[model samples]
Target: MATVTTLAPQAPQAATRAALRTALRVGWFAAAVFWTVLAVREGVHHGWPAATAALLFALAPDLALFVGLSEAPRTARGQLPPRAVPYYNAAHRALVPLALLAVHALAPLTWPPVLAALCGWLAHISYDRAFGYGPRTKEGFQRG
Candidate 1:
């Protein structure tokens, strides 16, 4: 005889997944708000260049994940191999942008390209956090 089943009874693992998804959503929203406010404030003070720079810098890094993963080896389960996680995470982590922002703030770098690039990096990283994209775990899973 055939058996019938339904999604009505979610497994324990499903609950965990759901919880993680909710947490990630909340985090993403908060990050987005923070970055948006910061970007707006900076744009107000620094002019359009700040926003433009940030958008450019923020997008470039995420591209690395797409580009990097294409080259990374996949596991039997079709997941990213653990070895490749850090490299993906490094590109996505906000630390780089955070540091750049700090350096720029503490002492205004006079080099136009560098300063703008840093600002852009800040914008990108912050937005990445907001967009529910966090760093990769050693298991090759996303922190988000």
Candidate 2:
């Protein structure tokens, strides 16, 4: 006797969720490009200080890794210490820099360096999200 087997179909909910995730990733990548362009434009127009600020702020988010150095026992390989999760999440959130940019725009004196910093920060956040990296859980692992 011959037996025929059919592949299991993915659930509708799962397919919808997957499509939404892909859409979000695409949006993030587009935001990354937008922020990067703004950062480079400000940096080039405003000279070294703006450029320097952009470079430094772009890398500043990962500096949260130092937050729990003294509480080393809570950390493990490929994970952050529980103490650092809050700091990491705060640093990685796009809202923080967005707020800063709004404030800068409304301030009496707008500074190119501040604009560069905000753009750089947003670019970093956007790129991370675009590449599937996001805030950690309270237990310090990447959220699913």
Best-fitting candidate, scored by TM-score? 2
lDDT of 2 at 125: 97
The segments of candidate 1 whose C-alpha lies over 4 angstroms from its true place after superposition are 1-25, 66-85, 108-132, 137-139
Local accuracy of candidate 2 as per-residue lDDT tens digits, 1-144: 999999777798799999999999999999999999999999999999999999999999999989888877656776888888899999999999999999998999987999999999999999999999998999888889
Question: Deviation in angstroms for 112 in model 1?
Answer: 9.1
Q: Give per-residue lDDT, candidate 2, residue 135.
A: 89
Residues 1-144 of candidate 1: C-alpha lDDT, one tens digit per residue: 999886666688889998987787677666656666665666566777765765676567655555445546554443456666666577666677678667767874453444555555555665566565567667666553
What TM-score, computed on C-alpha atoms, does each candidate reach? Answer: 0.54, 0.87
For all candidates, what are the clash counts? Answer: 3, 0
